[model samples]
Target: MARIKVRARAVDMLGRQQIAGIPTAVHELFKNAHDAYADNVRVDYFRADELFILRDDGIGMTLEDFEGRWLTLGTESKVGANDPGKRVWTGPRKATVRAITGEKGIGRLAIAAIGPQVLALTRSIRPEGLGSLVVSLIQWGLFEVPGLDLEAIEVPVVELQGDALPDLEVVTGLADRIRANISHLGDQIPADMRQRLLSELDMADFDPEAIYSQIDGPKLAGDNFGTHFFIRPTNPVLADDIEQSDDAGSEATPLEKMLLGFGNTMMPQSGEPPISAQFWDHREDGISRDLIGGAAFFTPAEFDSADHHIEGEFDEFGQFTGSVSVYGQPARQHTIVWPDSSGRPTECGPFRLRFAYLQGLLKDSRVPPDEWARLSGKLNKIGGLYVYRDNIRILPYGNSDFDFVGIERRRTKSAQDWFFSYRRIFGAVELTHARNSNLVEKAGREGFRANRAYREMTSMLENFFERLAIDFFRPTSQFGSEFNSMKAEINQEAKLLAKRATKTKERQGEFKTELDTFFTSIEKGHPTREAERIRAMTEERLSAVATIKSPEAAADALLNAEADARRAVAALEKSITVIKC
Candidate 1:
């Protein structure tokens, strides 16, 4: 009997090809740290050296655990046979247990997306005492070699004495093994490619002294048990992932945007422990900043400028119980029945939705013009309903290009009736790993898979938006019935004013002509100087009343005013008709 075997290239398929990009790769690592109960994770990039390092003070893995779990593909340690009771605990402290964010064992392979080579170091804490530091160097390029079997690769794992980390000699030895593999594949590959591979494996030039100096630093000294990954010659694509800022005209990298919805940045949840993340630039003239400490995109002014605020949770029965607050109006509690055609309990678990809606141009916003411009720019950049699971943001949801909730599609269908746009919403749909197990994300981190649960969830969300439109947006909109009434009033007033102006012009012309005749007759009679002076005075007094140069000009002015008024009335009527239809 023949048995199936996975080629060495399968690792590449599960890693670099599977993950979305650099940001998502970093996100996966962050999730891993979170599952390990890390309170903080610091990612540092050395621009000059093209090196990336991520350090976390989590409960690190022992040698046996690393071999059994980290090295094993598709391990079920986190899944625990799909039983929630047996799922991995986030921390050793049973008092505060967080649902594990990482279930697929291949998440660790995401490191391959970052770079070709990675040096992983970890020290575990045991019930007896501190475990020996375990270190492994993985050359992902080896996995990509054609015709190579998965078992053909040899990854050396070294356990250092006490709490000691691996030294340069140890790293050099591991790198030598990578060089040996490349040398073995020399005849099968091009000379130039082989030379390039050999050049990249120049571990003699690699110096991690700066990185080791941080081992006993403030962040890792106290715990002395955590995980550290040092990756060299990071993927060049990362350098291009720059976020152009509209406000300050500055630039931010993917690392800066990583912690946007982490911890209490968006909305704080009770009993959830705060996780701090930072990005350090170790290059000369580089600036190190706290990733999660930046101000939120939606400020108080932004929230206040919103036309409507909707926040609530869906129960297991698919009933939404929440409050809708139209700006300047008292909050009203409302319950919306889910439009479930299945007539059964939803497979999509209950999730919370919080969103602030803003109308285009912010015509009713009280914020100052300059401030509003800045806020509008932010909305255009970061707007869209974001989905968060356990306070961690799911990618492609809040992105300006990603229309995960079909908002843009709905708007395109009935543009006039669909008052909502993806650009006008600052929202979040919160879910938990345990409850939203069925709503699985795609392997590429693009979005949720189009499963029944996902369909139900999106259907519910769309229904809620429809209800919001009917209950709040349509009634308070400036393009509603009240607007039509105001336009009608203005049109009537304009028509009356135009008629009165025309009549007044005629009367003035008549008076001017009579005065001109009287003045001319007096001048022809050759009256005394006093009579001439009196006539001139009367003419001057009457001259002020003659506004229109001619009857035709006066008629043209009235015609234009009437035409404008008529056009305005027609537009208003058409709009009203559409709304009614």
Candidate 2:
């Protein structure tokens, strides 16, 4: 036999070794489906095997696009920068459009972890003025895979064969196996199962290609062209004895696999109010902000309970472990005050932690209200959570320490209270995640620019603020006594001055006469006397202005001179119908 050798394959983003087990890859597929404007997608199980199926009423794909869209890995249909001004894909009405999320494009290789089967079918969907083939799209053939002994076997990186779609029979058998696989999963399904599946299975509500129902308001909208996903584990399609099972675990079907879904759409921007918080005089005593537009789901038949995690599902690195942030406000813009090498804040540099308040908004089981209030002062805010929305994206600008928002002052001043409150989060997630100054700088610039362009930059900062407030800050001790002293100082100043007033009638009368003479002279073209009087008056007021030390002094002089004038207005207000609390 001739000697042959092969080089080792490198790991891409969707490599099986990169993800914990199976769920991560499925997540990629669902992401793709959303980009395609799929209304509802289901990964069903039958015959103890997994059958991955995603259907969208959006523009269907043709054979030409199968290689470009489905067959390609690391594709993102929604990868462009977010825009509030451009309402094109803001809600959900594109069938053939794509999104940007996955970077490696290696999700194809991950299919091995699901099963040995794969297929994709597609058709073209055109816009109203355009013809049928404007943009080619594809429907993935019912993808199926055989059980493989993956325990000791490292996944070999390989590409899918040819540009053809899978057969319809494969899809039918896959659907059948979806049912069979569910039975195989039996009781195990309930542990990882979620209640959200039943609704996701209702495909009509989720097509991404069709524009959805209505536009609610600014910072809120209704999903029209729907795109969503539902998935679950399956029973044993392979003979139990012949199965390539791992000592640490046995095989599971795709339908039996954990599921996640996402969707996007455009809404009429008519009701959207201009974005700003200066008008928010006080807290909003409402139920929710209704900002985020997606859901996390587990089949009721699978998990039975809504527990947030499944233990053994992650790799030893604990990367695939579940984490969720519910309640409070949605992700907010981050602040990176530092400039890049060019010394511009939005250009490049290290990272900076953006800060915001988002507590009492989330309905999660977590949060301690009293403690959060205490943490608020440290936050220099109230009733808000501080967290990072997206992983800070860093752009290299030489090797210098160009950290913009990574300073301890930034974290301590805006986020310290919250960070400390959640200090022990699985050890030190806050400290580790926020330490990347390089990333923060780039992301902040991007966000600042996006904000100006009316973009909703993604970040996990709300949850970050909440966790920090809960674990890091003491309920009554986020800040020092000095902060309290400042509040007291303001109150003292207000009280001292409220009872006093300004304006002495005699002095006022003289000043008024001088002003009238000066203005009258100017109109009569007599500048000399007017100019002199103005000079004298200005010279006299200087002394008064200098002698004034505090508002109280100003108040005292005016009150003594005009005490009688105050009574009229005060009495009228007091006599009014009601006072709002």
Candidate 3:
């Protein structure tokens, strides 16, 4: 019989290559904390030192649990594989139980995607008493060497008594081991390549003890047992992943963009445990600042300024029961029953959705001009429909560049009639792993897999928008009323102008008769030089008035004015008809 063997490179492939980017790597860590019933998690980055640390105040692991579960790849402990009825309690008190967000058990490997080496320290709180602290040093570079089996790469694990964390000497010893592991590969590779890899370690100035003192001394004081990670990114690309801006024009770093929605993704329902997350950036000047300080992507003002709003939940029957508010009107109960082609209960399950339609134009909004301008600027940068599962956001959905629901493509078909565009609406589709197990996220954390459940969810969203367009957006729009008012005003002005033109023609006739009488009187009275000049000028004016009163010219002018007004009204009517169709 032949047995299967795993290579050392499998760790590199699963950790560094499986995860998509830095943001996803951080998200996996946060999910792990959530599953442990953590109330708070803090992420810190030291730009000058290229050091990254994450601390969570959760129920940490014991040395036994660390060895049996944490070190075992693809562990099924969280999934209850052996005992189907087993329930995992989240907090140390066992008061709250949460469905585990992770099932594949490969999330621990995501740490390698951010850095080449990691130091993990954890202290467990069991029902009997506090357990000893478990320390582990993971050298990811060891897995990269050729001709090495997975079991041959040894990870150093230590058990310390009574919250005794690693000191400077312990950290230096681990660093030396990493250097030795890389140098040991010299027999398999060239000598110059070995020197280059050794130089990249830069371990002379590596200091984890100072970082621990700066963080743990004040935070983890007095009976605080949790997990902390100290990571040193030796690769320049990995360091730039956290510090550089996501776009050329953006001032916000990639880390800042990811943390902006921390703890703000969903409003907690009754009995739901709340989690808080924060990010601290240590600048080169030795000053630290919180990147996301209670800032929300959407403000109340933006919600209030929305022209249309729909919020409700979809039942398992593929029916939506909710209220729809249009243009500041009172919200009314609205329901939509989406017909499923499969003729079965929806596989997507039950979820809640909240959407706000913004016109993104000042003239269309009732908000104050200054406030609207500021909100518009924000909407332009962070406008899209977002997805959150168990109050945690799924990435690449709400980003400015991602059009997950196909709104942009739909708008291209009927751009004018379709009132909703990707940038003009803000939405959130809330899901839970317990109810929406079929709508699974991809391994890379980019988006949901293109499964039947995902397709059904997106199709339902599109149907909702279509219903909104036909029932509310088109009917309540100001275009029809404003166009009608304009047409009426133009017709009235045209009639008044024709009346004035006719009155002017009658006045010219009367004035001509009076002037002719005056000229005759001047000719009979005297033949002085001034009188002769006045009579000649009066005759010239009277002759011009006679030409103005000609039947052909007067009739032509009235007819032309009426024709122009009729054409204008007809054009407006045609436009309205097209819009309605």
lDDT of 3: 0.69
lDDT of 2 by residue, 74-152 (tens): 4664344232233453223433222233344434455444443333333443343211211111111112111211121
Model 2 misplacement above 4 A = 1-20, 45-52, 67-99, 128-343, 346-419, 423-581
The top-ranked prediction according to lDDT is 1
Candidate 3 at residue 395, lDDT?
72
Ranking by lDDT: 1, 3, 2
- Worst lDDT run of 10 residues, candidate 2, spans 274-283
Error of 1 at 21 (Å): 0.9
Whole-model Cα lDDT of every candidate shown, in order = 0.70, 0.30, 0.69
Question: What does candidate 3's lDDT look like per residue over 1-581, in tens digits?
Answer: 99989988887788778887776788788878877778878888877877878888888899888889988887777775223356565566564555567777656888887777788888877677777878777877767666678776667788878656667677666667766766655576356645654554554345554566667322333477778787876445645655646555244445555555544442323133356676687788988877655534665556667666778998876678898865656787877777664657788988998877766554455555677676666567666787877677777677766787777887889866666788767768888877788998887777889998999998888877766565555645432343234335545766676798898888887777656655674576632544455556545644554567778875675565556546655653443331110
User: Each prediction's TM-score against the native?
Assistant: 0.75, 0.32, 0.75
Clashes per candidate (backbone, < 3 Å) = 0, 135, 0
Clashes of 2: 135
